[model samples]
Target: MELTDLLAALVAADSVNPSLVPGGAGETEVAGVIDGWAREAGLESERLEETPGRPSVLVRARGTGGGRTLLLCGHIDTVNVEGMTDPHTPRIEGERLYGRGAYDMKGGVAAALIAARDASRLGLAGDVVVAAVADEEHASLGVQEALRNVSADAAVVTEPTELELAVAHKGFVWSEIEVTGRSAHGSRPHLGIDAILKMGAVLKELEQLDRSLADRTHPLLGRASVHASQIEGGVELSSYPAQCTLGLERRTLPGEAGPEIEAEIESLLERCRQADSEFQASHRTLLVREPFEIGQEQELVGLVAEAAAEVLPEPPKITGASYWADSAFIAAAGIPTVLFGPGGEGAHAVEEWVSLADTEAVARTLVALAARICA
Candidate 1:
């Protein structure tokens, strides 16, 4: 099948992450489709299902031996298509292929598959692995599973980057702050300690911290920051709220540690306690994905950039992404990793589409990269 057609087939499959949306179709169907295609293409393939009903597919173009293995990774699951019109039905308008996940990922997945097929014909000395991962939109379970079984010298996360080579991207940490207080009738102020009011102080401290973070910036990714995601406190109008909780997400930069962020939050809470003897608050880090940055001097970076220059009309931009990706996991596993993929728009939006021209260009570039790195 043609690359565009393969992408259309992938987009047509409903692979909404169940973790993001309740009862959503997981990566099973999409994984099956990819596995079937891999088998038909005569590529070695395997299905990874660490979590039931949420499977990932790994397709490999085997090499003769004695060279570094290169992994091309793309996620299979997509965000919900709540507001899209005929989202599962792929359509083409000029150079654009329109459908849910068309731009965000399926385009990249297709590019990797076709690139592996084409690159294998070169009979390179190294293997090319295509990882169609699952739940990247949520927890990145698929990539985590892939890493447990697959080892590679280097990896390219085929996330949509407009063909730019992304060497750095922000990571994130989720945390929750809970404040405790005494509940009493709303009519009696003296008898009640207002947890909500106490939470106000914590919010102020967080805001100040966020502002201070703006002063500390990364050259490629810019400043680290924090924002409140969800909050809940009051119960009923007639009662004083006994507890308040704030959920926040902190965007982290390279070299920032999750433990350090937790400590910082604890210090802020301590400050609140110092201000008011009754400021009883505690915080816990819920989740953390460390930031990813590969040095420009890495051989993989040079090879990918060279391939892009040859395949693209203009030299590709070397930059960073503002969003977190599965690249963090790949990098954490000790594999030098970077992000490169097709150009498009409307990722997780109502009108999602991938640039067909750019998709093909990305495939060509990946083929060229395999030749260089896997030689």
Candidate 2:
């Protein structure tokens, strides 16, 4: 299938991640289409059911040489489209293709599939493995399974990058900090302690911790960053809240690990503990995504650069990813992987879209990339 049509079809399928689904974050509605495509291609494909509702698709083709293999990985599921104006319908306006997952990764999946398709057509030197993974927007299970079971020389993860080769990227530490206090009636304010007040004290310390990491920088990922993504506390205004919770996202550079960042966050909570004996805080470390550092000099990076040169008259930007993707899992699995795909800065933004011209070019680049990697 042509990349544009494939992307449009994929987008129209409504694969809103299970997390965002009403039942649970377990099933993807779009898995069947990808599986059908794999089966039709005569590839050895299977579904890895991580849980009852969540399943990931894996497909592999035969290679000629005993040479190393190349892996093409992409996520099959997408983020929730609940509040979207017209969730299931994908539209092409001007030079852009607008849809829910069009930019974030369905486009990447198409490019990767096309690359492997062309590779099989031309008969490359080594095998090309393609994985249309699931839960990438929520969990890393799809790529994680592929990394554990599949062996490959290198991997190319198709994530939106405006055709740049992402060599380095930051990992993240997700944590929730909760504070507890006594509840009292609004009329008797002195009888109850306010969790909201406790949060204010914690907030000041968090700001200090955030500022401290500001100057810390890596060559590609310039600096460490932090954000309080969400917060929730009391429901009633008349009662003193017993608890308040803050959802935090900390961006980590090459030197940091998830556990260590969690510990650092723990220390901040400790400081809050010191301020008042009643300022009790609990911590839940959600997920620790590790940072990736791949230079353009690496063989995989070189292959992508050459492929970009082949597809476009202007050179593709070679840089690191600021946002996390399946690349982290590929790197964690010991495969050197870099991200290359269609679209630009509008990823995950309002009315996200992928450029038609860029999509075609990315498809051709993937074809060239597979040829180079296989050889």
Candidate 3:
């Protein structure tokens, strides 16, 4: 099948991540579509579903042996299409393919599949594995499961990078702060403690910390940052609330230790306590994902750059992505990984689309890369 057609079929599948949107269709149907294509291409394929109803397809073009294995990974699930019109119906105008997931990822998955199939004809000496995984729009359980079943010498996370070679991207940490106070009637000022007011102090501290982070900037990824995501408190407007909780996300840079960030938060909380002896609050770190970076001297980086040079008008730009990606997980697993994929606009937005020309170019670049690294 043509690359455009395969991508259109992928877009046509309702693979919205259920974790992100209640009752949203999961990756099973999309995985089935990819499995069919892999089998038709004469490649070895397997479906993995460590978690029920969420499936990931692993496809391999086996090589002659004795060379490094290369893994090409892309997610099959997409964010919700709440406002999109006919999001599952793919349309093409000029050089662009329009649909949900067409830009965010299904385009990259299509490119990886076609590249693996084309590269198999080269009779390479090493394996080429294509992992079409699930839940990247939310928890990223699919890539985690794929890592458990397969190991590779190197990996390429085909995320939307506008055809750039992304060697670094920020990671994130989620945390919450809960302030405690005694509840009382609105008329009794002496009997009640205001937890909401205490939380305001904490918010101010968080704002100061966020501003301080701007001073410590990464060359490609820019500044490490933090922002409030959600907050809740108070049962009624007339009563003094007993508790107030604030949820926040911290975008981290390379070498910024999670423990250090936790300590910094503790210090800020301590300052709030010093200001008010009655200030009582607790801090907890809910989740942490380390930032990903690779040195320019890495062999995989050079090989990919060379392959891209062969396929494009100019050498591909080496840069970093502001958002987090599965490349961090792959890199954390001890396999050197980089982000490379087709370019487009409106990822996770009302209208999404991918450049057909760039999608085809990405596939050709991947095939060229496989020949250099796998052979």
Candidate 4:
């Protein structure tokens, strides 16, 4: 199938992440369609069910033996399309294909599927695996299951990178800090310890932390970062709230450890306590994904760069992605992984689209790279 048509079919299927939106349609239908497509292409295909109805499509072009494996991974599930108008309907205008997952990124998924099928037909020296996983918009349970089931020498996560070769990306740790205080009626200031007011001090400390992060930078990825994602406190206007919770995310560099993040939070809490003895707070790490980085000299990197130069009008611009991806998970498992994909805008926005030209170019590049490395 043509890359554009395949992407149209994919975008037509509903695959909103259930974790992000309750009662959301998931990857079950999409995975089934991909499986059938892979079978028609003569590739070995299967589904890995991580959650009850969330299945990941695994398609493989097996090697002749004694050769390496290249994994092309893309998420099947997209963020919720609540505000989108006809999000599942793919519309093509000139070189752009508009749809919810068109750029962020069922377009990349289609490219990978076609590339894997092409490699299989060529009978390459190494295997090429197209893994369309679920739950990437949420907890990434699908990629976790994929790691347990497959191994590869290297991987490319097709994650809407505007066709850049992203060798490094930030990983984030989710944390929650709860402030505790005594509740009392609005008239009784002395009787109530205001947790909401206490959180003000914590927020100030976080500002200092953010500045410190700004001073620390990586070559390709720029600086580490921290942000308060959510804050909730106070029950009613008539009373001082007993508790306030501040949700934070710390984006880590490649070598930063989880303990360092915990320590940073602890230090901030300690600073708050020093300023006000009445301040009471505690923090815990909710979740984490390790940052990914790889040297540009890796063989897989060279192959992709060479292929991209052949396929694209301009030489590939190598860089790092500010956002995290399943690439980190694959890189964590010791496989060299990079992010590469189609160009577009409006990820998680009301209107989304992908560049038809870039989508096809990425597929052709992957096909050429697979043939070069596997042969």
Clashes (candidate 4) = 1
- What is candidate 4's lDDT per residue for 4-118, written digit by digit as tens? 7889999999999988999989999899889988888888998999579999988999878767888999998999897888999999999999989999989999999999988
Off by over 4 Å in 4: none
State the weakest 10-residue window (summed lDDT) of model 4.
116-125
Clash tally, candidates in order = 0, 3, 0, 1
Q: How does residue 37 of candidate 2 score in lDDT?
A: 71
TM-scores, each model vs. reference: 0.99, 0.89, 0.99, 0.97
lDDT of 1 by residue, 65-166 (tens): 998899999999999999888999999999999999999899999999999999889999999999999999988989999999899998999899999999
Check candidate 3 and list the clashing pairs: none
Deviating ranges (above 4 Å) for candidate 1: none
Q: Comparing 3 and 4 by lDDT, which wins?
A: 3
The global C-alpha lDDT for each of the candidates, from Candidate 1 onward, is 0.93, 0.79, 0.93, 0.91
CA error at residue 126 for candidate 3, angstroms? 0.5
Worst 10 residues of 1 by lDDT: 313-322
**55-166 per-residue lDDT for model 2 (tens digits):** 7777776667765688888887777665568755888988888888888788888777666766777766788888888788877777787666788988888888887878
Model 1, residue 177: distance off in Å is 0.3
What lDDT tens digits, residue by residue, belong to model 3 across residues 10-128? 99999999999999899988998999988998999999999998999999999999888899999999999999999999999999999999999999999999999998999999999
- Residue 254 of model 1 has an lDDT of 97
Taking every candidate in turn, the Cα RMSD to the unseen true structure, in Å, is: 0.8, 2.7, 0.8, 1.3
